[model samples]
Target: MRHARDFAVTVLVLGLLGVVAGVLWSLLAPRPPYVMTGEGPFLADPSTQALIADDGWFAVVTGAIGLACGAVGYSLSRRGRPLAVVLGLAAGGLLASYLATLVGGAVNLAPASITASGKAVSVFPGPLALTAHGVMYAWPTLAVGLFFALEGIAGYRDSPLRTPFGGQDPYGPLSSYDISDR
Candidate 1:
């Protein structure tokens, strides 16, 4: 029951983390500047392929999110197994990435036009015509890898052998340096 509770809390925290990451990605993502012609109602379609092709900004965003997820997983699963955290991160990351992509999809190559007087047109809000490639899965993969790496590092640090020599010193330094004396 405790384990189940822990898992739920971890997922909730990671999900919130994903939301923050997604918002940041959307805000930081760059788009090609374009102006619509006043010929007729324009349907501005900005695909993710073009957005990622220029600089792979999506990949960068996913990688950063994965690293953060891994760190959080490590912190949460200190008393348990890292696998649990990894799984939570994977699920949370996928959901978060999808939502983030949708938010970012709102920004199209050409701004929407509702009204125009001369050369300037008033833009309208609409759905973003963006698509997701394998970039969306990058977060979970990287996050799992990072969690294991951190777990291994933490294990190594705790693996150092300690032998008692004398007195109350756990590492057996010297009688004069014994902690029991103090």
Candidate 2:
């Protein structure tokens, strides 16, 4: 169990570093359609246009929820380590970002439909390489957050769910290092 705690702490620390690095990287090198890409704003089809508009709202709402999640994560993790606050917040951020992956799947979504200036277009959100971003970054973020949460709930402690976790000698293994002079 102590080993697990150590491992979890290491992961949380790495996750904190990741949050700092990711924010820096995002700021220093933002991707498109945010930046000036060769291909301008996607003149989406009608269906896609409507999808983007609706999904834009989804982004806003999800972002708000993500903020709330980060707050919750930070507050909860303070029970453990001060730095672990990062672990929880990072988790919420990753969880929110991952929802981007599920946005299409979680909801029965259709792309935005737009009929403007005689140009009917459909626009769906999520830029290219979104999957890569989620996999590479989100995984670590959620892992550390979950670890902190695990510690908070005492699930990492002794119980029937994890009898072998506490530091103790198993009856069979104790004979290996018995140094008594009985």
Candidate 3:
């Protein structure tokens, strides 16, 4: 019961934090307007290529959700280090997420547009964007979001219920309710 409660509260808090972080991050660099002619400053090069590709609102929302998940996991598993769990694996996780996004973003099968060309360029049907986005951006971001949320959960571990099997939650016996009854 306690662990369950912890998980729920932790998840909620982490979810909020992730949403906030994601929103703020997006605000810092909101999607620039799509220029009709050439590329802008955010794009990769001056070759009329739009700088930051529009990932859509879905990315922002889903990214926040994923971050919340990671935060929840971190909250459940951390040791003495409060911020350590989230902050600890953050860099590595971010890198993994980015790499995954790159791989997923690959449009090898169905060719994409280079610039303002509305013509369809089809090669294969192996779109990797969503795949890469999931690993590269989703998981790590959620992990960081969970870190913030778990901080609150950690504070509520006041009673520190001890189980017969020396486990946090009881799969066999000595859960929060049973232990109290005993």
Best by lDDT: 1
Q: Considering lDDT, where higher is better, how would the candidates rank from best to worst?
A: 1, 3, 2
* Candidate 1 local lDDT, 1-182, one digit each (tens): 66666666667776676666556665666544343557843434454244444236666877787887788778878876656667777776777666667656644344555544565564433333234567778777788889888888877766644322432566454554755767
Q: What is candidate 3's TM-score against the reference?
A: 0.36
Model 1 residue 71 CA deviation (Å) reads 1.4
Kindly indicate the candidate among 2 and 3 with the higher lDDT.
3
lDDT of each: 0.64, 0.44, 0.44
Cα lDDT tens digits for candidate 3, 1-182: 54455544544454444445444434433233322223422322334212233244435544655565565556556544444445434644554444434433332322234433675432222222331234335555666766666666665564344233455344544443554555
Evaluated against the true structure, the overall lDDT of model 2 is: 0.44
Per-residue CA lDDT of candidate 2, range 60-101, in tens?
434444444444545555465545455435554554344444
In model 3, the worst 10-residue window by lDDT is 122-131
Candidate 1 TM-score, C-alpha based: 0.62
Task: Give, for candidate 1, the lowest lDDT window spanning 10 residues.
Answer: 122-131
lDDT of 3: 0.44
